[model samples]
Target chain A: MSTTRRVVIEPLTRVEGHGKVTIRLDSAGEVESARLHVVEFRGFERFIQGRPYWEMPVAVQRLCGICPVSHHLAAAKAMDGIVGVDELTPTAEKVRRLMHYGQIFQSHALHFFHLSSPDLLFGFDSDPATRNVIGVAGAFPELARQGILMRKYGQEVIQATAGKKVHGTGAIPGGVNRSLTSAERVELAADIPRQKRWAAEAVAIARDYTLENLAFATEFAAFPSNHLGLVRPDGTFDLYDGVLRAVDESGEKILNDVEAGRYADVLVEEVRPWSYMKFPFLRELGPHKGWYRVGPLARLAVCERIATPEAEAARVQFDEAMGGRPGTMSLAYHWARMIETLSAIEEIEQLLDDPDIEGDDLVRKGERRPESVGVIEAPRGTLFHHYVVADDDTVMRANLIVSTTSNNEPMNRAVESVAKKFLTGTEITEGLLNHVEVAIRAYDPCLSCATHALGKMPLVIEIQDAGGRTLAEGKRNS
Target chain B: MSESFTFYIDGVPVEAAPGMTILDAAQAAGIWIPRLCWHEELEPFGGCRVCTVKMNGRSCAACTQPAEPESVVENDSVALREWRKALVELLFAEGNHFCMACEKSGSCELQALAYRLGIAAPRFEHRWQAREVDASHADVLIDRNRCILCARCVRASRDLDGKNVFGFTGRGPERRVAVNSDARLRDTDLDVSDRAVDICPVGAIIRKGVGFTVPIGARRYDGAPIGSDVESANDELESANEHTEGGAAATVRQEE
Candidate 1:
């Protein structure tokens, strides 16, 4: 008789949020389907209801500790509309951009060095005991130290601009509250050369790892999907504020430069009963085919070029290496992430040199509007914050499309692709499951932000027969 | 004229008038006895009890207890510190402070007191009680979720502003600050310039459109502890006394 069984890997490791994967195998022990399940749920959208509209910028930071600045800026941008100012003062915009690049720099550095470096350095199928950040620290001490210091530098930049490292109140409706001081400028500028060098070295590390394992990198969970991010009006990489653009796998613009306020017109989110995270897709293509990949790889694919010189050069080389096509390789995310890090550091250097960041003309005023939408390219990917304020200035409703939610479909596809390629039998092993986790980690999914929940569960692999009886079980507590 | 008397606070001599409470005497002597509901501009309500101090072997509200002659007061004792810490923690647990996003964060007396007393987080479980916000007023917002029942606004509105715009309602956990009107704050005679708006020790009552204007580091309490100003005044007094003693000793040495 033909036998069908399911294998479940619960609570994936080395990622920001709590999630699991379940794969079903056919009679031939061939993978049939795999799904990534977000296990926690937090109703942040409902939490922000009835709060003052100005509080959104600070209150929404509670959504994700890892990327509170992203939420802060996104909500502030939206509130800028509620206050009816389409453009901010020069100083306000620059300070906010500085804060954002600092966030991107720190977030990307942390992911590459602390989270993903272990897999790249030690190999995916290595001993599960030492296959972590500790392992990376033991093997590549200097690289690990650089990662930590780089993260600290970025955090300092954040504190200097946002007033606090976590849950900053720097960005407010209409404008920012404070400008960068000249002393802060000098202090941050002093570290730019070192940061630039380290960022360049990080890019090299990711690039070398990808090229060294070219065969594995190209084939691992590789597939064509749509890409989405923000791009400057001049078609260059922009992480802070920009018009939204999305392209298909062939680099064709499916959704052109749509203003951030009009994002709801282009994208729609579909909810499934199985997971708390909603699947967001291009409105024109429907849910199935409209699903797209986000984050570093998607940003690189969607943007025409990086505006900074060093990063632009790196992007050129990256494109040349990809044969001038949008790279669908899941592992290539590390390379793109490093390139963006370099770009962020470069932008930070330029902003520090500019005098406008220290200007006192920080706030602006305009007429009021009841509804507004804010979109920005967060460290992970495109994040959207939409709010409808009552005439009394309280938030009537709020809808958030976090980066992880946008990449939900892509991450599921990645898990299935990896499982199909790696799964050999009904019994789940550590090495085989790590392969699945490695694919998901490439997306750098923040399930906490995606599900808007708290707490996490342990990792469990259950082998179930066709009748749903558990045949074998493996567990790893976290 | 009131009769002046002398008392001892933590063994330090403090002079006070007959009508002065222990808190008033401490402040006059440049000693800060932390009190939430004893603003200088308002009558002493003694509601918070954060200023509870042992006077003549009995604990009493320092803000209301009269400073008697020859009275020995025990302030800043370890037991008093812990009791005060618990009181602050309870106040924190009773309200949904949300200090992180509050406009009054750095300048807020409650938060500054918590920092001064080294209360990292409330030990008790948070009472996330549902509360109402009165944003109907054109220029004033009363977010009752942050109210600690200090009654500063009630006192200020009635005594100082002469508008009687705010009052207390309900009892126990249900008790909260209420507007004089049956409905929202807009219906009340409260104005933006009312001292009641500025007298709130927390974000419970605040002027609208003025939140988060001050940068983090420049705020009132960011540079020092909450009572540091009062403590600094004590430092200045001690230095002055030392200078006087030095001058007298110099004169004696010259005579010798």
Candidate 2:
């Protein structure tokens, strides 16, 4: 008789939201298949229905604490369309851009220094008790301090532009509500040199770590997939606002320069039975072959060049390190994320120098539209917010595709790749499970944003044979 | 003209005209007694009870109670403070006051009053009851979810605008601001310029398209607590009175 067994890793850690991995093995103890299950559901899209259209920008910020600014800006952009304002005043646009860059810089800094550094500094198989930000601080005190300060500087920038740190009312429909005062500009500019230096140092650290672990990093959950992001009309990197672009594994444009409003025409979301998250794929390529990757790795692959000098140079070095090919390594996400952080700092410096950011002409309005879409490159991936407003000014319908939701398929693929490569026996060991978590962390998935759910679930792992008798079990809450 | 009388509130003598309510007398003397349903331009309804004070050891709504000669009234006692705080808390629990996203967050009288009362969160169980929103009006929106049954709009429309566009419909917890028309603010003759449109102490009645226009920090009560203007005015008046009294006493001594 053929015998099969299953291993379940419940409540995956070191990532945002609640998720679990189930690995099934064949009769010979060979890994058969793996699936990542998102256990929570919020129905946030349904909750926003019937609310006033103007409230969307602030209301949607409740989606995720880690990326509230992303939702705020995305919903604001969509509402900008509802009010019929195609082009914002220079001051308004620059202020919004400054807020976006601050968000990306701070979010990246937090993920690297607080969340992912533990794995890189201590090996994946290291003891769980000593593999966290606290451990990193204890050993690498100066680096850890730099991380905290960098995150703080970025948050200060956000506070100045967005009004407060959380659920800011800065980006309103039509245009931004306020602009940076001269004093605010001066204060933020004072630390630009220091921020730039730290950002560059971060890039070097990620680059060195990836290059040194070339053999393991290259094949860890690595696969060929399409990349997607937003780019300026001139094909340079743009995070806040731009036309949508997608490139295949070989760096060939599959969808080029599509307006955000026309995204539904080229991309469609597919629902699977096992997970609450939706899988978005390119329409022309079909779901089977159209699953793509997003976020820092994808942005680095899709953009032609970085606009900032220091980041542009780092991008060149990255491309050379990859042998002038499209980067498919999941571990390289850390390196790509640091490069974007440097680019955001450089952009912040330029914005502070421009006097337009302090101008009083902050809002403009035109003919109103009934339907609109807003797309932005959130730190994790491309985020989409679409809304239909009724004549009474209430939202008729709302559909949000958060960054983590866009990376659902890729995350599953990553987990499967790691599980197949690491599982050696019926017993699920801690070090082996960490390998699976490390792959998922590379994507920086925000399950809360994806599922729109509240609260956390305790971690539990169980291994069972075909008869359902438990062979091994482990549990954790932190 | 009738003769005025004097009364002591919290040990401070306040002068009042014949037929003036305690709240009116306090306001005329530049003292803020914190009333919600009593607008200077409209008649006092005394519905909110946020201005309840002890008059001669009896609890009375300051906005409606007549000022009596030599009457002792306690306005800011510990018991009164706790009573007022509980009233405010009940008001918060009775409505879906989502202050975080409310357009009137910084300027709402209810929110400002809560801040002044030092009530961070409501103690009562929140009644998340379903409320109707009337957005059919071209220039006005009535989001009843935020209504505290203040009756400011009801009086403003009936007494000030002479349109009588608003009135109350239900009793107790069911009470809500209702338009004169069968349904919706648009069906009524209420105009965007009517006093009723701006009379709502909360966000229940708002002019459409004007919400959240003023940045947060620049809103009405962002810099100071709700009745600080009245308190500061009282301070200036008392100082001027002291100076005048000192000069008059010096003159009398020289004449003697």
Model 2 Cα shift for residue A219 (angstroms): 2.0
Interface RMSD of each: 1.1, 1.2
Native contact share for candidate 2: 0.30
True contacts kept of 1: 0.40
| Residue range with the least summed lDDT across 10 consecutive positions in model 2 chain A | A454-463
Compose the digit string of candidate 2's lDDT tens values, residues A35-146.
Answer: 8888899997897777788888888887877778899999999999999999899999999999999999999998999889999999998999989899999999999999
Candidate 1, CAPRI quality class derived from DockQ: acceptable
Local distance difference test values of all predictions, in order:
0.87, 0.86
Put down candidate 1 lDDT per residue, A1-478, tens digits, no spaces.
4478888887677788787888888878888999999989999899788878888888888888888999999999998999889999999999999999999999999899988898888988899878888888898899999999999988988999888877778998989999988999999999999999999999999999888888987779999999999999888999997888888888899989888778889899999998999999999999988999888999999889898999999999888887777888999999999999999999999999999999999889888899999999898999999999998788899999999999999999999989988896644678889899889889888888999976543456777777877777777765
**Candidate closest to the true structure, highest DockQ:** 1
lDDT tens digits, residues B1-256, model 1?
Answer: 8679899998899999998899989997887787788899999998999999999999999999999999999987778988988999999999999887788888889987877676765699998999999889888888999999999999999999999998899998899888999979999988899999998988998887777778777887767656657766788554543432223423332221
For each prediction in turn, the share of the native Cα contacts (below 8 Å between chains A and B) that it retains comes to: 0.40, 0.30
